[model samples]
Target: MSEDVLSQGEIDALLSAISSGEMDADELKEQKQEERKVRDYDFKRALRFSKDQIRGLTRIHENFARLLTSFFAGQLRSFSEVSVASVDQVPYEEFVRSMPQRTVLNIFSVEPLEGRIMYEVNPNIAYAILDRTLGGEGKSSNKVDSLTEIESRIMSRLFEKAFESLEEAWGSLVEIDLTLEEFEVNPQFIQMVSPNETVVIVSLNAQIGETSGMMNICIPHMVLEPIISKLSVHYWMQKEKTKSSPEDAEHLSKSLNNVDVEAKVLLGESGVSIEEFLKLNQEDVIMLNQSIEEPLVMHINNEPKFYVQPGKQKRHMAVQILGETRGEEE
Candidate 1:
């Protein structure tokens, strides 16, 4: 290179910065120091799960929810619906804070998956289950009572049953034998993970007949980090494909194809209070918010999937496709 050149504009900008103290020696040193400074990290809280992993966890626990629903129904000999309410990554302390102070906390470990996991049963539901077991009509109580020998036996039985369902739910992803290592009533004494460590909190709503309560499972991020790759969407889809034979897959497709789904066209919607709704007659008309020219909503499986126009198809009524909803994407 013959010579390096600095344009007049660049020179003027540098001179201006120097005069304004932006490029002063102390300022330059401060800038470098700031650039080199490391971020302050709190040891008490950290998150590790990504959105996709959270979605996968939600899907996994949804299966667990259905299993628990049926399990509780059979055990209670009554109607029971257990649903996974939410799956979230939270600090271990936050998870503990949301749990009942006097509820039973069963800490367990599974072979092939390292570290302890926590399972909590709300006292209300636990009491209801125990009440039903003792031939008493199922009842819920907020009172937290110490478990005597007989109650402990009942709890042990319930814990075993829960573990069996959990293991089965996890079987499609990984086969592991869960063993209960410790059980405690007060959560303050329990340490599933460090206070700052992030854990996945799987919250569940359990309904026993008319009574209802909540349950939760705390899984530390460290425990899942080893098998993190298996928690991705593509990995799960691949796993499902590998589990099915060609004939079985064909059978599944055919069965699904034969299944009937609710398909209806929405005219429009109008909201009414209880008093206004009770006063209405069949012939009385309620104006809808949607315009007449707007495409009607086509719903399948109770979800809006398409917008279409009302039309005639020979002798039958038909709908012309307008567009699909955001949720209808491939």
Candidate 2:
């Protein structure tokens, strides 16, 4: 009150008190800057998935989400749409703590990958499915605390089917077998990842007929470390581009038209010893397993391609294709 202009230190102290409510303004500012700063870049606490990896996983799981809806529609004969909600990286402990007290957590491993991953479905979704499967209306009002023995069994089947769909959806990227390791209701007891370890979470929101719920897939960075290269956009794009184009197919057909193919006709096969072969000198008959009525097998490039019968085509020893082998893929 006596001085017109206070000293710089006096002014700063008064300003800090007004700005920080008795705390040092500079200290408050510095504390705010300490949160998740990139400069802090702790190697032990790095992101589970990079931005690119998260984008790739988003693209991959979007397909899975769409397929999941269709699968539910077919099985439950109901309308539904499961959409990818978000892909994020968070500390594993944060995720575990966010889970409800009563939740069904499925721990599984990818056969082609090294470590385990987890799948968590909301209880509302589980109950809705249980009701639908048990011939009741597929709707829920209150959240379930725990699944009964019968309910758990039913949910296990549902989880199996969902994982089958997941396996099929992941087939193009990596042929993985999702085998369940264990199931738990108490998340505190489940320690799939260390408390501070980072994990990648892919969330899918489901609108199954009348019920709406969420599902999460948690994969620790360690599990994805080995095949992280496969999670890049370039790899997926190259795989798509490597498929035969129309021009490529035409060129292949034209080139094959000019090349010579070694074709052979086989009646059948019969087990004959080496001694029996030595005994046969000239014009010795070897009994065949296939009868005369049975069609001969046409061997193209040493592979049995088709069943054919010996016939005359324009005065040539040609054979007609009767049919193809059953259960053979093209």
Candidate 3:
């Protein structure tokens, strides 16, 4: 609003010029209009996603961060963390230039969508994961280098499993099947899109154990162009409102039923001192804490849940359920 108002000096100068017959008021208005600045827009680096769409991408990737964190924690068998650092739209060439000489670049395709997406892992993070997977302390080397054949295979399998998390994260907005298409170490080798093409980079800060590094997911505008309209707050909110049917719940229950769980029947316990245990022979007998009449405890996934009677059924050792145990108590 202040830009539209003229300062006292400017107003006085304008009035003086108008009264001097050197400048006509109507002509001055035309001159002012002609002097208006035009904002420069580069088509090469055009902003394909609006602020709302960017926020939507941020939300989608934030969910991906949580899923990836859980997946890595289980797969790496170590402490893992992932979080969305930033989301920015830039030219594809700039993204390539920003990448290191040697790093993990996984180009994957989203089925039912046209173009591919680049999932890049920084060298530090990649080596750390490789180190941890190979039974190291999850420490990365000071110098970055290309992965060996075996290392590439390991990483490919690891990230392929990670795609499940990505798919789940985007499940709300779209149903996509992500498949790894190619793995490359050099960014220069990547030419899936034009250098001037617009891409949205979702930077994720990932930490595996003590090692931390950046992981980026580069999505070109052409890939998202098909579903660009769905990347909006309104669309996302609408998707959130969709409710699952009873059949879906039934299907989920059926899936859970198929999952395997460890169940073991605990036998009677007996204690022995260190020296006594060391000197004990194979056939040596120790007095049991529980009598044969007492029912044994059955643990499901390490949690005591049922009491059972140990016996032989059809020449096979088995346990017959007596009753449910009251938690840890008898």
Candidate that would win on TM-score: 3
Candidate with better TM-score, 1 vs 2: 2
Model 3: lDDT equals 0.90
- By TM-score: ranked, best first: 3, 2, 1
Q: Of models 1 and 3, which has the larger lDDT?
A: 3
Measured with C-alpha atoms, the lDDT of residue 31 in candidate 1 is 72
User: lDDT per residue, candidate 2, 101-125, as tens digits?
Assistant: 8777888888888888999988788
lDDT tens digits, residue span 122-232, model 3: 989988998999999999883446456888899888888887898999887789999999988889988989999999999999999999999999998988888889988
Question: With candidate 1 superimposed using the best TM-score fit, by how many Å does residue 185's alpha carbon deviate from the native?
Answer: 0.8
Evaluate candidate 2 by giving its C-alpha RMSD to the native, one decimal.
Answer: 20.0
Comparing 1 and 2 by lDDT, which wins?
1
Global lDDT scores for all candidate models: 0.83, 0.81, 0.90
Candidate 1 yields a Cα-based lDDT of 0.83
Q: For candidate 2, what is the TM-score?
A: 0.61
Pick by lDDT: which candidate is best? Answer: 3
Worst 10 residues of 3 by lDDT: 141-150
Per-model clash counts, in order, read 1, 0, 0
lDDT tens per residue, model 1, 163-272? 78888888777887888888778899898667878899999998887778888989988778887888899998787687668999999999999999999997878998
